[model samples]
Target: MIERDHPTLSVGRQCRLLSLSRSSFYYRPAGETELNLDLMRLIDEQLLETPFYGVRQMARHLRNEGHAVNDKRVRRLMRRMGLMPIYQKPNTSKPAKGHKRYPYLLRGLRVERPNQVWCADITYLPMRRGFLYLVAIMDWHTRKVLAWRLSNTMEAEFCVEALTEAIQRFGLPEIMNTDSQKMVVSSRVV
Candidate 1:
């Protein structure tokens, strides 16, 4: 777990040597109150059941369930959870500076061959004590997973590592699809 041997080395190279996901290295524990944790858990479960519920509906549902939560609290919790009702709406999530926003390039494009298009997604990993983030690449045509990596931090570099490994193994795809998440579109890594 010590990188002292390689003085002034790149972090990604160090991470590769340890057989550990870079995310596992930077995961931070939630510092919210126990009550807020309870509320977040409740809100997460409810959101899973009804992703369309906005803060107003979530607050009402929580109140009906006797949680004593208000809309403002619910809104904050939802933002923390990265939960959004999937629908057509303004792009509320913004990318970081200099991160290239790749237009959705695969709208009606037919993926008739392997590696024609690939998609990447980052997800949260629930643990008994804490959580980690997982990034994965998938082939659009065969629905096959090409590469995946997990990390404890929200840094974009872990996603870059996953992307690099995917490209090394399968070569670059004609199109790579990802949500508006900043990590996925970072030009610094590309």
Candidate 2:
């Protein structure tokens, strides 16, 4: 925390003591304007109805609703609200650059026994207010869910926790698969 008008301490000194950057200490977040807020509300309501609407579609919808807005503004507001079209889009599954790529090892291998292969996936569960991220680890042969965890944010910690729990309960599998690009192959798995 930073106090602007401290009794004796200077702002710079307070920032240094708190291990915070001077710029961050001085920075204040800009609030959305009334028009932007109204647009955001409309976008949210429309998103519930048409989850597949992209920037262009959203802009057209707003225009039809009598709001004079451009695609750029709609795109910015959608990004700010963390909303994305739910439909499948091309090139959305690219792996991160500089990350080690592992070949798909289960192409021809048969999963004859439980724990032979395991798969994990993360999905979003829509709720009344927002959505929750669900991560699950399952046995490939048996199709049994070994562990699951729900999180408000889509961070790797919950997925890692679920994997850890599954391994602890059922022991390690011969192979593990996931669609996430951020998953790193540990030495134990290798």
Candidate 3:
């Protein structure tokens, strides 16, 4: 709670004391117009069927469906809704600058035991309202899930927690492999 008019504390001082941003403390959400909301719903439904649609393509789609929308509006709506075209592109998952790169050690290595090789990965699970991230650790040889965690954000903490739980429960593997997206944190754990 924020006291707009306190006896001694100013609003800014109160916000600072509470560790809250002044802008956020005074922010008010603007309601979306009904027409725009309807268009957003249409765009979301269309996105479900065509996950590869970009701004221009989506605008064309909406136009074809008898909606008076342009690329700029579609782009803004997509940005607001956090809708991005899912496609294969070069350099999509590059490592952060100055991060150490590890050699790919499992090129031809054969897994013979349960603890020989373990793999971990994080993937997005889309839901009706929003999305969640799933981090899973699995034994390569046995194809068994050692540990898994679900989070609403893609923070490294959840991935690290999942890895720690797996290691604590199933013991350390000879090699733990993970996708490049999560390699930065998993490397620290390994």
Clashes of each: 4, 0, 0
List the lowest-lDDT window of 10 residues for candidate 2.
Answer: 181-190
Better of 2 and 3 by TM-score: 3
Best TM-score among the predictions, by candidate number = 3
Q: Where does model 3 exceed 4 Å of error?
A: 1-94, 181-188
- Encode model 3's per-residue lDDT on 1-190: one tens digit a residue: 7798899999999999999999999899987889999999999999999997888889999999999999999999999999998864433255678876677878888889997888988777765345778989999899999999998876679888998998889777878888772232333354
| Runs with alpha carbons beyond 4 Å of true place in candidate 1 | 1-94, 181-189
Alpha-carbon TM-score of each model against the true structure: 0.46, 0.48, 0.49
Candidate 1 global CA lDDT score: 0.77
| Better model by lDDT: candidate 1 vs candidate 3 | 3
Query: In model 2, which regions exceed 4 Å deviation?
Result: 1-97, 181-190
Task: Give the Å shift of residue 40 in candidate 2.
Answer: 23
Clashing pairs for predicted structure model 3, backbone only = none
Could you give candidate 2's per-residue lDDT for residues 3-81 as a string of tens digits? 8899999999999999988999778998999999999999999999999888999999999999999999999999999
What 10-residue stretch in candidate 1 is worst by lDDT? Answer: 181-190
